[model samples]
Target: MEFSASKRIIHGFAPAFALLLLGSLAAAQSPKKSDYLENIALCNGPGHTSLAARIGGCTAFIDSGQGTKTALAIAYNNRGNAHTINGDVDRALLDFDKSIKLDPTYAKAFNNRGGAYLRKGEYDLALQALDEAIRLKPNYGRAFVNRAGVFLKKHEYDRAARDYDEAIRLEPNLEAAWSGRCWTRAIIGSLQAALEDCNKVLQSWPNDAATYDSRGLIHLKIGEAAAAIDDFSAALRVDPKLASAFYGRGLAKLRSGDKAGGDADISAAKAIQSGVDDDFVRYGVRADN
Candidate 1:
């Protein structure tokens, strides 16, 4: 019942909305028109996620009547964001294409389309989309973040870290950017720095199961068996169905002289979904290897 590792990894990282080369894919408030426009400007202006929701609502409003070509382009761009948030990459790409058809200079749309391409494993297309995005918006941090993901997939950790660093400089408290940096660092064996970024993410929004799962990996790396177990257990506490946490804690238990417990946990993980990934196996304790 071992499913493809790639698929399981995709499933594990599903909630995070980060795309790997082989892989991947929030909130509300009401307001007046001026307030909405202001929020949209801030969201889109800063490349915050709120832009997706705000643009979606604005596009719906524009479609009612008095919609100009420019207005329709904006609507398409915004709707593309909504689609992306909902994991409708195909729809997102179509909306982006429409936005560009209406306004050839829609940089954000290009960036988002590049994101869609990345999710589909079309690296060249992703790079092209991101390049256009950067060309259109020289100071766009989101484009840099997206491009960094491509680099991470390609195993160009240093390049990815550089992009993540630039993104951080552009937007200090951007949680996604920070998490991307943390992940890149973790891949490159910089567990301490990765832990710092994880801490920052927790500070902004604590109790993230993924964050805990990731931190557990870091702890395992640094040889903190007991600490790793605690983190994995906490991750399971937050989200019981996280198969990786079970596998992780199982490995930790096995490594720390609890073989029976480890076997039981791995059995539990396989039961949850008998599929397992080799890369996931790589993440297990050294003894597991």
Candidate 2:
């Protein structure tokens, strides 16, 4: 959305920490070549969660002699993602670049570079990298999803939807693709279909507060003020700090004639994030007359 100045184009780190630290401790005690490679595999995993232990593990594996170019490529990519999660984006991009150089046809490295570009607000470069990733690996669901995010950041809603569609088609169970499509549809397309997509995501990930907030916005858009309020409340129960939920609930409350409650929620939302309503305004939502 054009409101990205207030809201990030990409959301959430998508991490699992316990398994990593535990594995790291265990591997540290007995550093075998096989064990080191194992750590590399987990650290640069598909999710690219960017945890510190992942970086450490990849570093260890890189220090060990790599068995193959593919292994080295994966280690570099994994370390880059670890850097990304650690907020050292410059280092992360360098690793992604190295990974690509190591393996000219490494699709995931290209996709990851695109993600790094998004963090840097280099939308055109991001798109080019994602395009190359998809071209190298047509079945790359993650690449399609990243491309979709780039399109969304550019406000190219239809193109975003198409990329999301392709992502879902490639990986029917990829939750992010479903949620991305749902959010995009909420902003510019069919509310009903968007609601359905939200429901589908919730059925799989019931505790996902962001999806609840997304569905709340859809309800608000469709004139279901009470429903919107309820959905927003559910989201807050899961994540109290979700500013978007507070902002959406505030609007829903006002629409339902709860002026005091509306004002309070709006204030809470802004206390959490100053420009919380820009996303809604960009989507054409307005106060009840």
Candidate 3:
């Protein structure tokens, strides 16, 4: 099973030129107008903005009481995104609910809500929200990917694979979709296809630890212990605390006749995540093998 979290889909602002135009408008207007424009800009800025700043900006825009209903809904959604990133899932859910109440058709809000639910381990609620998001916007690749994550957590590999397939079909360049599909296919014993998917992600995002871990599992499944060790080591280099990588590398080490190293790695993995061995067992890998 894939141990990575689902990618959160947040709404972005318009082009920089639009912000420049807003700046010009603010310059020609009252200080109140300038403050509103600045607030909106800070609220909708990209991921570079600090979570606290983004939340403050969104709150300023929301409390100003000067925006249209649609704009207010967007502000709520943006604030919810910030809250989600800040690890305040409950607050994020409240903001998402407000956004949905204001704009019932806001697919991004639903998608984000589903991501929050996924973080909270509320699989049923996550599925409901993602299902609505996909229903509202059938072309929503991110929603499909998030839904696939729920399926993965539920151990529904086939359903997860189907969702990942639709997500890749809708957005071929989505790295999360490819990485997720790789993990799903790996668990389902489709080694070659899973390797292809992992290769595609690594080609674009070499630093992705989850993809490296997925590829490591594939190599382990195919009895390429050396390659599996290399891949798992690479994953551990990227994220040292990744229990799956440690556990997988342990298995590879054991297969390669390094009993001491294997035992140490397995111990470390268990220290990081007590259930790591069980996850490997579900993936059809075993220390006894």
- Provide the lowest-lDDT 10-residue window in model 1: 10-19
**Residue range 82-150, candidate 2, lDDT tens digits:** 676567878988988888898889887888888888878889999998899889999988888888888
Give candidate 2's whole-model lDDT: 0.77
Clashes of each: 2, 0, 0
TM-score per prediction, in order, is 0.73, 0.84, 0.93
How do the residues 142-249 of candidate 1 rate in per-residue lDDT, one tens digit apiece? 788888877766667798899889878987866667777776676678889999998888888687677777788788778788998998898788878777778778
Q: Which wins on TM-score, candidate 1 or candidate 3? A: 3
Q: What are the RMSDs of all candidates, in order?
A: 9.5, 5.7, 2.9
Which candidate gets the maximum lDDT versus the true structure? 3
* Candidate 1 structure lDDT: 0.66
Worst 10 residues of 3 by lDDT: 12-21
lDDT value, residue 156 of candidate 2: 90
Candidate 3, residues 149-204: lDDT per residue as tens digits? Answer: 98988999999999999999999998889999999999999999999999999999
